[model samples]
Target: MAAPPGCFVGWQPLLLLAVLVVLQGQQLRADFGLPTAVMGGNLVVRDANGINGVLNAMDRAFRRFNPTGQTDRLMQASAVISQIALNVTELGRSVAGSVIKAASDRSTPVDELFAKLQEKYGRMSRYLDSEVQNAIETLNKSIGSAQSLSLKNALNSVAAAVRQITNSTADVGSVIARIHETTSGNTIFKAVDKASIPADLTTSLSRALSNTKDQLTGLSRTIEGMLKNIGTTNAFLARFDQTRQATEKNIVGNQQGVKAFIDGEKDTTVKRYTNTRNAIIADISNAVGKLNVFGTNQTLLALYDKHSEEYTKIYYYLFNRNESDIQNISSAFDAIGHNMEKIVVDSTRSVNSEICYNKYSGQVINTFPGYQNGVVNCMTREKNRLGRITDVMDRMLQLILSTSQDLANNVASCTVWNGFDKSETVYRQAEACLHTNINEMAKFGSIIGRELDLVQTLGDVEVAASRYRLYDCVAARNNEALATIYVLNKDIDGCVSEPGLQRDVLGGGEKGGDEDTEDPYEAGASTTEEPVYDEYLMEVFSNSSSFGDDVDKIM
Candidate 1:
């Protein structure tokens, strides 16, 4: 017959065994001439023990039947809890060897069934705990990195590329105008070096192309090195992700196993514990019932049962809080851990604004420790790496600007030469202007070389050197163009000076002598002794737009 669901189907045979044990013990006490009332509790306990011994004998017999060569750990737990209640039920319901006979044809029952459930539980707690510790350590490290990182602020923000480049625009204005005049005046072919200008332009263009090619080669190498570092960072991120995913999978599967183990093991063990408790209650009731028998009254032994064939049987399960509460009582709890990752989120951004360019939510949690340590660790490391790159790149950008400004000053000296008229003596004026421009260009190069040599960020010095070669080639081309003009200007030195040029010198000029020729700040230190902002150095030249600002000690 099919047994009822959600009930112990083997309880029937176990109850019968318990009754037989009680009767046999009663008979033994009668033979010993002991009164039933005086021997009541002791007899029931003795009978229960004897019945448990029989059940252990069952364990030894069934051990050979189950192919698994190990004891059922859950059943073992049940067996230890007032063993009779636990063992009798398992033995009766077991579809293995018949209870009456086991060696008839040496065939066990089920006639056959899955037989791999006999192994006991192992120390899963130890493995899970070790993993948790590692995960937490990683989280702590990540948190620490985030907390300790430094970032830029208004105070620490030195002038970057934008500020540095624009500040020198005034200084180069004249140079830009000169380049325009030289190129445009070449239309007449009337300059002293008119015959040689074409060759000068060709040499300048050729050098520009060659310099560009060299810059491109250096740039390619720099890009390749950066790409390799990026690849390594990506690999590290992938490894971090893989470790997190594997840990999550293991933790999820272990949760399921733990749930199943508790539910299955509890089903049998709780029943055994409950039954033993009920039996003890019933035994006491029966002892009271013995006294009631003399008084001719109803007894509690008739109450602990739901199916008692006594004169009066009131079901305790119906009246007391027993099996009826099964639906209401929680036998299992599903774990739903809440990760409040807000702490990491809130603090990560607050540590340093420059470092917190993006939001980092370290929110992966297989368990509390996994989320707290491992996920936080991984995310923090990834974010911190990005912050570090931004810092390096920002510094690189600043260095590039400083370097570019230096090159611009060198190139601008020739490029921005203008405001001089195209007169017969224009060539002489061109040489004076060229002399001043070239002197400042050489000074810029000297300062730039010193500054660039001090910088070692990501091979920036090498990058700057390559870039300088390209700009220097441009400056060389300009020098050639200016030299052609200088030749023509010098040739006109023998030709009586034009009145138009003479008027420019007398009307739009400062009639200074040796002071104009000497660079007061040739040694590169300011008279005020205040540290010069390297970007601001270009502003101090006599030819610059800000020349009138402070022309005494440093101009």
Candidate 2:
């Protein structure tokens, strides 16, 4: 009943037994299958986590990397541009001030001219006074004469003629002074006051008084003609006042209009530029923040594998957004371009207005002095004529007053000074000074025009520089963003291709099971063979072993 040495009675057939053991091993391996899925899931999850982490890291790096430093540098450059623009503006202001001062300096000549006019008017006043006195004396002498009837008629005619001349002289003097006052700041008054009067008024007044010796010159033709001349002079004076008033009013109105335009332009232009620059800075900040948030290696890797499509979409979206921001920046620059055009137009208007004012001033300055001189000369001639008449009357009157102590002491001994000659000389000198000032004012105006042109050119250059500098910075930022997008896309693609990610996340296929093998007893030749051990190795193994006999036996 004992089993053979290599076989037992309870043992099954070799093939069946081998198959059973192999199946058992297969079952054991199968028992670990869920763990494999878990491990695979862990690998996929790690891959996703790693990708996300890398992307986040990259994003952090990008965000942390400050481009603001470059932006600050650009801003500094803008400040430099602003400084240049300010310099140009200041230059323009300086030129304008200089020109204005030059124009005002012409007032010196104008003042001198006015003085000459006053002197001429004074001489005429004195002449009229003397003529009135002479007429009174003549009338008195006639009344005392024995040829009373004829003498009375002659005295009356002389008296009437004298009154008419005095009246006309008074009217002329009043009109001339008013005209001079109205154009006081003008140079022409000096020249006119200095020059000689024309023959017409002198000849007419002389003739009118000459015939007055016969029957009280009944409103003589000469006096009437002199009155007509006075009327003509008054008309000219009125016209001169009107012209100056109108010019001044126009200049004031134009200056106000230009000031309003310039203020509006500055406000609008500065607001537009500031708003645009702020908007651009805000957009750049946002875009950069976004880049920082999503540009990490981990996130890019995760996006590369699991969400490549989304990654691509986001990348392009950011790119397009940045491009849109750049376009907006360009539009802002376009607004600045419009501002530049407005400034140029305003500058042109200002220059033109200044030039126009200067031209009008020059014309007024040139003409008024001569007009004043002529009026003065007229007054002077009238004065001289009246003086001769007054001189004759004074001699006759002196005979009457020779007995009075006060008359003898003050009036007789005192010289009758004529102011006409002195006034004429002053008028001439003043007129000369006015001429010089007018010429200088014209030169200053020309210089101002040139300075304005230079300022405008400098302003244009500054605007161009500002626009170009901003454009360069924006373009550079846009290019950088685009490059980042490209890099992120590549990283996402690589992550998507990894085998670890494909197997676990994609659920493509299961792993192979453990294989079966032949039964050891059936395949072996000997069942009782012992493994050999060396005694020296056994002693060394025994001395070092904690499980003494078993380890020693195995050795």
Candidate 3:
């Protein structure tokens, strides 16, 4: 095509095509290898085909080959080929602009790949079933016996297209590879980064990569097979792509296993560290808890030892002799209380506890919600009972002292060493005093015995020990009464032997009537079953009296 003289190109939409056409003219002219363009400038209009005239030759060849390859088949193929050519042309224009833009911006140039239904891939891909294939099928159906010549031509066209897919994919791969190299580090970035495709490109990019892989894999599998590679499949695998699918599945499985192993190792390490930390903490806590208990119990053990020692000393004091020292007894009691106060009651002051019980049974009962209070109350009652035992012992001690003073006074008055007359008077008086005091002591002894029983049973140490002293006192008084009765008989018998006294009066009394009334009372006999002197003491008194009488007869 030739441009008009002084042509003014006003079509803005077709400006790129017009420029390409002008370049095509200049190319055609210079291809003669001449030094200059003949009668020309750089400007001229051209057809859609460049100087190679590939579309033009296809037209002319189909027409010339029509005798062998029929005209109708050629015409049908021509339409589909023409559509494919148009799609390629448009895709090329768009890609060229994008590439130029990429060269300027350092961005991805293969913009067409992201498009699902673009001209180059989507429309051109349809040609496998469109004109060239349709023409071959039509001619094949028409054939009665021999293969049609037109079918061969149609097949050649289809073969050419299939070859072009292979050749063109290399060019597309190079462009995509460059884009991949540029975007590898940062998958998602500005305008032409990996985001331009979706899992990170690993989002959009993975899809793009998967699409390329599937296309290449499908192409490789497809070209390796004949018609059998087209459509048949099972649920397990696409029959045409079974080998490639298996390869991809194995690769994916390996990647997942590697990821899972790394993750498992990380989790195991974390769990191990956590368990170690917990175990160490537990050990530390256990050791510290034991140490704390050991430290806290030192005072408790000391108090127990001290209490035991004091308890021993107190028992020794109360029961060791016929008389117990109240000071020693009080001191031991107070010391034990002090130890309890420090060890038991001191800490119990702050401690609160929940105490529960079934309360329906009928009995003497005291209840509180807190166990600390209950412990305090029990300790107090124990102390009170101990105090009550001491009080009982105190009363018994006072009674002993009173009775002991009377016995000592009466024994002092009766001068046993004097000659019988004066001694007899004092002795008789002492005997009457002894009898009265003995009887009085016996009454208190019964009382003390009962009190001692209670003290021994109820009291822990103090009152239980006092039982010995009280019993000793009672025995001592009984012995004193027997001694007094024996001395009185000796005094009265010796006085009868002296010159001043008569024997009859000495044996009984000064008056016979008085002797009948008073002397009827026997020595060492009492109204109650418990005698002031036991049988042995009474026998000692009677025998000594008979000895005095025998001594006077011998004189």
> What lDDT, from 0 to 1, does candidate 2 have?
0.30
List TM-scores for all candidates, in order: 0.22, 0.17, 0.21
Give the alpha carbon lDDT tens digit for every residue of 1-555 in model 2: 887887746545677778876665444322211111221222322322332333333233323322222223222322322232233223222322222232223233333433443343344334333433443333223111111222224324544544543443333334334544554454233334312223333333333333322212221222222222223323332453455444434434443444444344444433443343344334333322332222333422232232223333333443444444434333433434343233222222211211011112344233433433332232233223332322332343333223222212321111122221356554344334333333432343244334323333434444344433323332233233223322432333111111221111000122212111111122346632222111111110011011000000000
Q: Report the poorest 10 consecutive residues by lDDT, candidate 1.
A: 546-555
User: With candidate 3 superimposed using the best TM-score fit, by how many Å does residue 356's alpha carbon deviate from the native?
Assistant: 19
lDDT of 1 by residue, 162-237 (tens): 1221222212223323333554423331223223223333233233323322332332232232223223323333
Selected candidate, larger lDDT, 2 vs 3:
3
lDDT of each candidate versus the true structure = 0.28, 0.30, 0.31
Global fold similarity of model 1 (TM-score): 0.22
Best by TM-score: 1
Clashes of 2: 32
lDDT for model 1 comes to 0.28
Clashes of each: 11, 32, 10
Where model 2 places Cα greater than 4 Å from the true spot, the runs are: 1-227, 235-259, 291-457, 460-555
